[model samples]
Target chain A: MADPAANGNTDSGGSRIGRVPAGYWLAGAFLLVVPSFASNFVMYQIFGWSFILGMISLSLMFLAGYGGMFSLAQMTVAGLAGYVVAICGTSAITDISQNWPWYINIPAALLIAAIFATIVGWLAVRTEGIYTIMITLAVASAFFYFTRQNYVLFNGFSGFNGIFPPQLFGVDWRNPIAFYYLALFWAVFWYLAVLYVSRSPMGLALQGIRDNPRRMAALGFDVTLHRVAAYTFAAFPAAIGGILLTWQSAQISPGTAGIGPVIDILVIAVIGGLRHPIGPFVGAFVYVILKSFSIDILVALGMAGERFQLLIGLGFLAIVFWSPDGLLGLWAKLRDLNRRDPLIGRLVRRL
Target chain B: MKTRTLLAVLAATFLTATAHAQTLKVGALATLEGTYTALGEDGMRGLRLALSQANNMAGGREIEIIVAGTDASPDSAVRAARKVVEQDGVELLIGPLSGSEGIALRDYSKTQPHVTFINGISGAQETTFVDPSENFFRFNMDGAQWSAGLGEYIYNVKGYETIATIAEDYSFTYTQVLGLALGYCAAGGEITERIWVPLGTKDFASIIAALPDDVDALYLGLGGGDAVNFLNQYQQAGGDAQLVGGTIMVDGTVLSSKGDAKNALIGVPSSGPQADTWDDPNWQAFVKAYQDEFPPDQRFPSPSLMATGYYNATTAAVSCLNEVGGDLSDGQAAFRSCLSNLVLDAPNGEIKLDGNRQAIGTNFISEVVELEDGTLATQLVKIVPNVNQTLGIDPETFAGFGVPGRDVPECKSSY
Candidate 1:
């Protein structure tokens, strides 16, 4: 039951109000120049997907790390936003899309996704541990089947294709550079927002509930309400990620919210490290790279290319075994070793 | 001066020929993992066989293949498609072996206007007929097109009055059910009930028990492992309804694995390109090539519909590439024009694209039978030729058919 407020420095001295970290500035500068060095495919397929998927996994990571809720329905929340975008936006398959303006569609998508997540969270928060996992999983499974069968609304199993990001302000947002920046902006915004919230009073209360719900309730905090509120807050990022995903692929289907993808978000979060806010993005980077190129590597190795999943599984297993806290935890351990050795510490500090 | 002019002309000709010989990258996308892996593998084999047969050259241009694997999901397929087009810079694309994936890839084709996308066994109707992409061409029949004469065959030939339909709940199965229901109801047959099991469902006990006892036949639209499970369970449940179905119900894997359940399809006519049934030279050559590539001990027992579909698609692509001298710089308009009016003697007969760039060709009414080697194979019972995407119905009426579901055709009376 770690106190959330103790995790980061507060603005007690007022030396730096909302100061941007040097590491963040460095990372931001690098990301801004990525399109110049990388190809359009790398921009869209790798970084773009990594950011979007990172955000989705971040939602799960937030719930698990801060609120002690392991939700399997984060992807479902994202998928709901995707479906709302498709239902509201124009597509090639069905005539159902009202062709609403982006301003209306974007907000409506987020609202619907948030509302859906809150309801699911309300139901899920009543349970604890594995029961919570099972309930979220059930909700995810139900949504998948519902979208698959309900043709009139969800367009049956095919769902909707040709769901492009609205071309606003005389620019196609789906263009590689624009899309990358859009995804990056949302991802970084949510990451900072999550960091800020985890230190906020409500975040402290939620963490208290996560650690000891009985004590929190006895102390006059509505534990369930806080947990549900955490879910509603988390849904914003997941929903935004979903909207981006729909834009990236220009489509939405049952497979978007399928069980495999639902599990994948958990895998991404765990592999990146659930403890830190940046862990999911790290995991997403590895995941997107592996998914895009592992097949080629397998084929080049003179093996069946389809066995890429085997490679991915092996990588995930090795990472989990190496550090349950994920890549970030592994990094922390190396950093500690560096600090213990003066020469190594100097080299790291110089870098 | 005359000799120098001759030398210059010859040099110019050689340079032009060399320039035209530039390598053309073709990307093959398929679900290499998950439930449809075998189908995807077969499609790859089929494409490879076609490419090898052409000496890996089309229209005097060297062809380099880049294979991309999807997990049979639309999201994976789109990502894979983006990789092939944007990263690999493949001029031509083939495959993505699922119904939803096909539609996704078709929509994706709109974004990649310069790249020509050919279908690789995905049979969703919307991939072509609903919102056809100028850049995407399907050289094989869609699910509905495959169901061309199954309803009429079952009603008039087999004398089935009322039928119950059990299909996977997806666009592909829906199109299949619509194809059969339209023909059967039109031929004075009634669809008593329609049961749509979700994709990946293994249990058919509840669905079987729900079937009407008076059903004269049961049309199955399940595929691969799901079909095997359902057939076995349907048999164990003591269900005696005469089982007929779409092409997937009688696939090679289903025929070989279903054991006694395969008897349900022994005399029933389904639709697809079965090698044993369609005895054309082109068809024979394809089967022979496939058998040569994959020996008896190899993974695939025989060329499945997926294999043949891709084989035919690649074959058409190569033929067109040859016709146009392998130059796709003009992009979609050039490829579309080359494909639209051209007809090739494909494995399934004459393969030609309609105005919508959908396949208009033969649909073989096939039945399961024990081959000389004791292996079960689908034998050609009848041939439905020149079957278009419309499935013998008027375009307007077919459009009005709506999405296929339970009680779609409005059964008049039970015989």
Candidate 2:
């Protein structure tokens, strides 16, 4: 078993490596450009949502792949951040909130989201595996109810709209394609940054703790501290996602923290294989694209749009039962097998 | 720099083309997904139904309504609107289902001065009575217009002394609930307590449990699914009270899904698409056309946000368009000058735009009752004409949240 405390990074005087898996990056680019070219409408709806969901799923990747923590509340944390944006940053004309200028309000929103996430992490990180899942789920459910009933703050059901994107480059960055690329750039940064961190000493220690908590403790790794730190680190990406969601929707409703959306992050992470960095994001892309189009398909088949949840749930179950390692893991296995089977390839070429 | 210059030139060209277009391009912006998906879909249907009917105008020039549906957020709405106006070059626009999205469009309407925004049933009172922009025209009832008749009846007709209101805590509900309070208090009824719940709240027991008998009636200010949920829970919990609302109650759309809410509440609503369509053969043909396109079950019992309010709003616009010979300036000026002077027939009434751009003429106060056939329905028990008077503030002084006063309206009378 790998030591949870051992960092993936070998300290070679902080040398930057230009090397990356070209095939994987190529595959990703292929996926990104296809939808943008196929239809402008799809670009806005599917592409935009995927990148935001990608950042959200990255939070789960941090916990599961790095810290060996399986968390369900990462999406809830992101949603809480979105609610914070709505409350603090929204202009009075859109939501009930007045323009609480960016300098003061943005920091306050992020700080509050971080503190909220930390408290959630403090509670959930105590348990392991399924128990942790349950606790995280309960926290998500609790937040959902709080936001739903507490009308004065969350605007109750019909959520506040009219959050204009910050005019950084003098453009309403709320435009879907622009927001999607921004989110993509951020997701890439988080991915690379997390990759580097995973190779660092802290990441190694966390991995050690994840593999054998008792052994890591004996080696002075502070197992609980490592778990909590992992959760906190995970929250930063989720919060970034939440902030982006505030941009995408231009308004945050109580539904932002609702049960379905929170659980959706878990499904994405697990379906893409919780074992890898790129897994959750890959799963999110599949989920968002399928979901955006499935409505029309369902309507054609004489099904209600509300049946969307039912379809997604069934798909998730199918993924879990049939392929525990998820689609990415399956692809990797197929590729490895093809590489080894030179005889089979030669036979096929001859035929 | 090149992108900026191109965009500027493109936008300018688009605006110029829009102003000079012979074929009318009407932008339909809405949500075809998520919680209020049905409402958004309905709004879109109204646009299709209206646009198709509108294209059969006197002149042979085709009026093509280009549509755009977003995920029903202010951000998405703005982006979608920009695409419609800038990319598509629509002369006029409609829809964006939610009050919040409509408000965003109202702001955007300022940038494109000549583009007339015929709203799609976003009934925030501020959209008209407060923030009335020259480019924007709200063709349906605001929160106050829909609730005014019922408010007057509950206060004066029924002599209900005290009332409690349960509504979704968004701006639509807030403005709606407040409209009820304003009307009720004006006619001598005191609102004892107000409970604002979220839109998709599955349960209402805790809220219902909190209610006391101090109030004679309860006002349910929710729509479609949430309304059904609230009423079902309220009734099952043994809370026996006369329920009323500024929302759909026993109407076709409400009753079809919520057969359980039968005889449980009095519903006060402005005219809906299917409600009055039973009397019109043309409307029957339209419903037949709709059923031919989509299955009867897939469509709501009545035109909801789309068929009901949005269709009516569009029909009003069509009427105005026809009256002014398809000229936007003439249409808007005619609407603004003497809306009630319009003799155009409609599913609702004469297509009249009041001073505040709200449809004036009649507000229906209906009672929820069970038919012998065991179907739930609202029978129009009352109709209050020119209900725009209930706004209290006169024809002028309609502005935004800031400036005059965005505070909750204060009632001087306790009794």
Candidate 3:
């Protein structure tokens, strides 16, 4: 056996790199060089959208998995950030948008998203179990209606378009290759951050509060504060994803954070397995792929393209029914089953 | 012998290259999901009808159309557009069936100068009015233009001096309301109230209660499900206000809905791109073709405005293609020139683009009438020709009212 310290549990920098599993290293390498081989559509529309969604869903995972809160307002928060960026930055709605610089608008978006999430957390964390879901959903619906109606700031139903990313480094950041890297960077950063925080003291306290609020409170932890702080922490990734999403489409509208997307973010988190940091990304990939290609798939099956929602609904039901903990849980179960059967285990290991 | 063999190979290569270059790819986009699915389907049907009329050939090039769907969101519409453009590599794109989607497509059209984009059914004024794209062409009237003649018709013909307005709180509705308000107010009519409701509001009890009892008529700007819902609820509440409608309020989509509510819509004055019962030979022929093209179960009794918009746009595209002879070379300069200058004798009326590539087209003033078949349809009242985006007002004065909103085009004695 190896010492825990040598395993990089207590090591820093170079040693930590050495301790990373080969699978993670391979994934990292593949993700880094994805733009080299991927088509512009794949890089920009498929993977770029997946990473942005994954990051937002990651926020949901952080809340539900670590804090025992199934908040549907994560997308709403992301949308708020997008709205902030569009309103603060230049957009086609010159009458509405303040037209601030990107550097200013981006940070402002993050700050505003964090503050909004904090408030949502404050209201939501007071409730337990299904009440929290209901509250977040209500918040999401309210924001949708507000944005769709308030033309002064949100520009009503036709929200801000022509809101492109800053041309930093003499490059249009929304260019497929550049956008791919930008999304990848944020997705990986948040994933690693979530992983790190999951093992940290605050994460532990939040988990403890989730599992047993009374006991954690007895143990001298401020339950509400930790929960709200978790929301603040999760908001950063979601806000970044929102900013990227707005840039990707070069637009932001109420539909971006409508009730459909709010539920979709929750569905992505749950379907990917909220049990691990990597689950949301996996789920986001599945969703993005399905969303992008389901029409073709349906058409191939000699079905109408409009039945995509039905297909997605069926897939969601099947995954929820078969794997209560999602794809990751199903994978673990298969691995365990393979371990019990030596022949299958050998085949799996060889593959 | 060697020289003859080389000449044969060169000839074969030339023939194959010519054949390969003779195929034109087109991308058709619509909202096949969410609230506007039916509209998108009709839009596609209209496009297909136009394509079939052209025998799917334009400018000597065989047309290949790829269809994509959106949920009426700008982002999804843009993504779908990108997929068709970047992946399918289409040289032409048509559609995007909602207001915001049109604005988004207009922006996207700027980046893709090579691909010719024709407007689908989206009627937002800003799509072409504000920072209009060079490559994007709209062959259908915007929402404001659709309201041409309705305001005057209401004030002069119906003689309703005081009116209250209720509309879906969106840009399209805002523009439509602005159009009617501008004309009605200028003609010495007064608007008592303008109530703006969110797009998908199910409950109309409160809205019904809020309607001023003194207004001569209630001008409803709601569309699709909202129109049906509001009419249903209003009838249920037993409210007896004389009803006027925005373009979409009295569309076949809502009028044909099976309910006692639509009965209240009878005699309701409205204006739009098409009147279902227009006596014009071209319109009747177009309706016959539309009805024949799709089975009764798959379509409305008459073609909806959405179908008309797409049909007009597709007709323009096909005609322009024939004019340019399928030659998209020189960055499609010739094709675009043909498009800009072409006056399409559309099924609805003559359509020609203005300086900004926006359509200056005809509008139909009509009122709801129950046909002998017990289906609701619009009967023609008047036809307003050459209605521009500015609704015949000076561009400077029109812009001075600012972009359409709740309180925009403030009702006054005259402009």
User: On TM-score, who's better, 1 or 3?
Assistant: 3
Scored by TM against the true chain B, the candidates give 0.90, 0.79, 0.93
Candidate 3: residue B120 Cα off by (Å): 0.8
Better of 2 and 3 by TM-score: 3
Q: Mind giving the per-residue lDDT tens digits that candidate 1 earns over B276-387? A: 5566777777788888877675545578888888888888889889988876775546666887888978776888888888888888887777777767778888888888
- For candidate 1, give the lDDT of residue A245: 93
Q: TM-scores of all models? A: 0.91, 0.78, 0.92
Q: How well does candidate 2 score on lDDT at residue B304?
A: 55
Q: What is the DockQ of candidate 3?
A: 0.27
Provide the TM-score, chain A, model 3. Answer: 0.93
lDDT tens digits, residue span B1-415, model 3: 1222332343233121112466898889988887677778888889889999999999898998778899878888899999888766788899878887888899899898989999898888888998899999999888889998888889999999999999988778988998898889888899988999977778999999989999898999998888888988998898999999999898877887786888998999999999999888999999999999999998989999888888888888888899888889898999999999999898899999999899998999999999998999999999898999998888988888887778987999776
The residue pairs found clashing in candidate 3 are B59-B326
Task: Give candidate 1 misplaced runs (Cα > 4 Å).
Answer: A1-6, A10-21, A88-95, A214-220, A341-351, B1-21, B258-260, B332-336, B400-415
**A125, model 3: CA deviation in Å?**
1.9
1 or 3, greater by DockQ: 1
Q: What are the per-residue Cα lDDT tens digits for candidate 3 across A1-351? A: 011211126645656567676667657766777677667877888779989999999999999998999999999999999999999999877887898998899999999999999999999999998999999999999999889878678888878887889888899898899999999999999988997887789887887898899999999999999999999999999999999999998889898999989989998998888788778987887787677667767977888776777887888889889999887767667655755646554434333
lDDT of 1 at B115: 86
Task: Provide the global lDDT of candidate 3 against the true structure.
Answer: 0.86
